[model samples]
Structures are given as structure tokens and as C-alpha cells.
Target: MSLFKNVLYFQAGFGFLANTILLFFYTFIMLGHRPKPTDLISCQLTFIHIMMFLTGGDICLTDIFETLNLENDFKCKTIFYISRVMRGLSICTTCLLGVVQAVTISPSTSLLAKFKHRLKVYMTYAFFCIWSFNLFYSSNQIFYVGGFTNVSETNQMKVTKSCSLFPKNYIIKGLILTVSVSRDVFLVGVMLTTSMYMVIILFRHQRQCKHLHSTSHLRASPEKRATQTILLLVVCFVAIYWVDFIISSSSVLLWMYDPVVLTVQKFVMYAYPTITPLIQISSDNRIIIMLENMHSKCHKILLNMFLPFL
Candidate 1:
């Protein structure tokens, strides 16, 4: 395999592992282990990221499915549609995560505080809406994308070795582009706005804590740590997302897909999903504490076993 394939495989493997761990952690919490309000959203986000890797692997690692003898059109459309829907869900979930966190950390008297009690209900409704919208919105990919059969054809833009986007009317193509752009811009805008709100909240909170206690005595709250983690995720997602977006949009508009450009775009596209779970696992206090306890248990067991020999 080439270096690009090697890298993609490594990324997919690592991301899959990280996301699985996160999914299980959230599952454990949901199963009555001190669950929090944001656990549901976080769990959903992890699931979406996991699906992204799976769908992505399906597209890039075609060798895994050679025995199925699936038609190219079916393979392309199914994979592409699912991938697009998952991508849409990823952003929408992340955006909702940020907004929910902001609401979660708001002052008791603040306007956002009212939704805190009904947060779970709202999250459920929001999730349903998000899934429905994305499933419908990404239907366009099913119509436009297909397997590349004619190597001589210049009208279609090849996305992968086998999958290409069939040409559509310019007006229809432009409309699709506009809708996609608008959706991304709206979601990104909400994420940024909420992030700013969170930053202010954290700042004011720090000041209050400092006033109440000395700098050395003050420790970060769980809420503050969660907010910081979400903020970091938002920043990382926005940066990587725009790069991927620019490349994809440019490719669509220019009616071209250079190999090098596609490789770089793939890297950018995978970066966020790969990094997100690792960040969450590392930053979560509960995960850290659980890991510490597990380590302690292992050490104790090893010491007891060795003591008899010693």
C-alpha cells in the first residue's frame, strides 16, 4: 500500500478504537452509573463518529467487500449517502453539544437556565429532528454519485477509484451547493456563538471562584472542565471542517479531482472524527478517575501475587 493508504488505515483503526471506548463509557453511564445531562449528546456524537469511520473504511477499503460482488452504483450510492448523512449528523451533534453545554453552565437566573430541567426532553426531540433532516438532506448524493464505469468520461467527477459524481444541471448543482453551504454556515455559526458564551461564562466563574477562595485553593469544577473540552472540540472541528469544505467545494465547482488534492482532503476530513473521542476520553474526569482505579487494582493484584514468591 502507498503511504496515503497506510495513513488512512491507521487513522481509521485508531479512531474506531477511540470511539468504541467512548461509546462504551457513555453506555456505562447511561446504564445508571452517575449519568449527567450531556451524556446522551456525547454518546450520540461518539456513535456518529464511529459510523463515519465505518462508512469511510467501507468506501476506501473495497477489498473487504469484494466477495459480495455488489454493483458499483449500489455500492457508491449507499456508501456515499450514509457517509453524507453521518457527516451532517456529526456537525449537528457537535453544534448541539456546545449549545447544550452553554445552557448547562448558565447561571441559575439566566435565560438559558429555564431549559435545564427539560434538557433531556429537548435533546431527544433535537436528535430526532437532526436525523430526519440529514437523512433527507443527503438524499441528493444518492442521485448524483455512482460507480465510475467509463474512464473516458470527463463530465463526471471521480471521488474515489470507483465512485464518481454524475453531472447534473448547473442550476440544480448550484442549488445543492447553496443548501449545503448554508447548512454548514448556520451550524458553525451556532457553535461559535455558543463557544463565545461559554468562554464568558467560564471567565466570570473563575473570577467569582477566585474572589471566594485563594488561587491555590481553587480547583476546576466538572462543569468547567466539560465546557473547556467542548470548546476545544469546537475549535478543532471548525478549523479542520473548513479546510475539507474548501477542498470539496473547489473540487465540485472546478469539475476536477486531483489525486493529491483528494488525498489531502481525506486527511482533513478524517482528522476531526479521529481526534474528537481521544480528546473527550483524555479530558473527562470520570474516565481519568476510572482509569486510575483500574490501575490501582492491577497494581495491588500484581503485588499480592509477587509477594508470595518473594
Candidate 2:
């Protein structure tokens, strides 16, 4: 195996493991009793966790390119179709999450704030729409994707199934790229605008507090904390995703079939979802306290166990 393939496999494995742990943690631990059922932010995080799992699966599928048998053309097509759909949905859902967060943090005077209360109510419907859009848009891949047998003789492989886009269907490929790029651009704009608004608001609030005769607690306010967390999340999201998008876009434009490009793109694409759990844990005070409590209890238990042996 090539160095690129080895790196891709490692990334796929890590992403899959991280997402799986996060899914379980959210479903069984973090999601119970603390956050209200009607909390839009909580629902949004749950949806993101699902997207992470799907993305991890897509990465894992790409990692196994060398091991997959190409005997059945139908199976190859199915794998390609599913992988494309999942990857598309992952990107779409991630964009939706950013948009939703932006709206959630908008100032009360802002137009987006009017819809804040409706986030939980509309979130499920929005998720459905995102999934449907990706599903339909990616259906073209089902018809165009082919195994190694259909690819050029120079790139043919043994004991490996390759999924390649048909050169004749350049129009469909263009459409896919357009939609994906447009969606990402819109989301990035929203996040940038909202983050800027948040910074301005925080600064103004600090100034007002300083001018007041009576001292007021501003540092520990929940609103301020949430804003800070959101800002951090936005920064991380932009840093990881912008680079990945650039790489993917460049690869498409150059029509490069290099395994190294694909490998880098795959890792960068999935890294965001894998690392999201740590971001959430760090930002959430309740989770942090719970973790500290658990650690103390474990320490006590270990001491007790060693006391008997001593």
C-alpha cells in the first residue's frame, strides 16, 4: 500500500471510532434530563452527531478501495451510490448546522432572531429538506459511477473496485459542484456575519457595564459564555473546512486522479466531525463538571482497591 493509502486508512479508522463514541455519549449520557427536549441547540447537536457518523462511514468506504472485490458490477454501483449520498448529506448537514447556529446567536433586533423560537419546530423539517436535496442531487452518481472495468486501461487495478465518474456526464458533475459550493459559501457567509455581530455585541456590553455605577457580573454570564463558545466553534469550523473545500475544489478543477489528493481531501473532510465532540465537551460547563466528578470518583475507587492490596 502507498503512504497516502495508509494515512487515509488511519484517518478513516480514527474518525469512525471518534464518531461512534460521540454518538453513544450523546444518546446515552449527555442527552438525558439536562437539556430540555425542546432545546433547538441540543437538537442541532444531535443532528450533527448523526452527520458525523455518516461522514465517518463514507471515509471508511473510501479507505477500503484496495481491498474491495470488483466481481459484481451492481455491488460496486451500490457502494458508490451510497458513499456519494452520504458524503453529500454530510456536507449539507454541516452547512445547515452553521446556518442554524448563526440564527440562534443573532441579535434580537436582527431579522434572524425572529425565527429563533421556531428553530426546534423547524429544525426537523429543515433536516429533512437537506437530506432530500442531497439525495436527489446525488442520484446522478448512481447512473454514472462505474467499476475498474469501465475506467481507462492505464488506471486499471487488480482485486480492487474503483468508482469513477463518467467523462461524458460532465454536466452532472458541474451541477454537483455548483450546488455544493453555493451551499458552503452561503453557510460560511452566515457564520462570518453572525460571529462579527456577536463580537460587537460583547464589546458594547462590556463598555456599558464599565460605565455603570454599580458593578455587574459580566464575565460569567450564560449569554456571554454561549457567544464565546459559538465564536470558537465558528473559527474551528472555518479553519478546517475552508482548507478542505479548497483542496476538493482544486482537485475537481485540475481533474487530478492522484491518490494523494484524494487521501488528503478525505482526511480533512472528516476531521471536523471527529473533533466536534471534544469541542462540545470543552464548551459545556455541565459536561465538564460531570467529567471532573467522575474522575474524582474513579480516583477514590482506585485508592480503595490498592488499600486492600497494600
Of the candidates shown, which would achieve the greatest TM-score relative to the real structure? 1
What is the Å distance of residue 146 in model 1 from its true position?
1.2
* Candidate maximizing lDDT: 1
- Candidate 1 lDDT over residue span 169-243, tens digit each: 889988988898899999999999999999999998877786675643345576788999999999999999999
Q: Give candidate 1's whole-model lDDT.
A: 0.86
lDDT of 2: 0.62
TM-score of 2: 0.74
Models, CA RMSD each: 2.5, 4.5
Model 1, residue 197: distance off in Å is: 0.7
lDDT of each: 0.86, 0.62
Candidate 2, residues 76-187: lDDT per residue as tens digits?
6666666566665555554555566657656788888888887767777877887787678777766655655644554432223345544434776678778777877887
Q: Give the Å error, residue 90, model 1.
A: 0.8
Task: Flag clash pairs in model 2.
Answer: none
TM-scores of all candidate predictions against the true structure: 0.91, 0.74
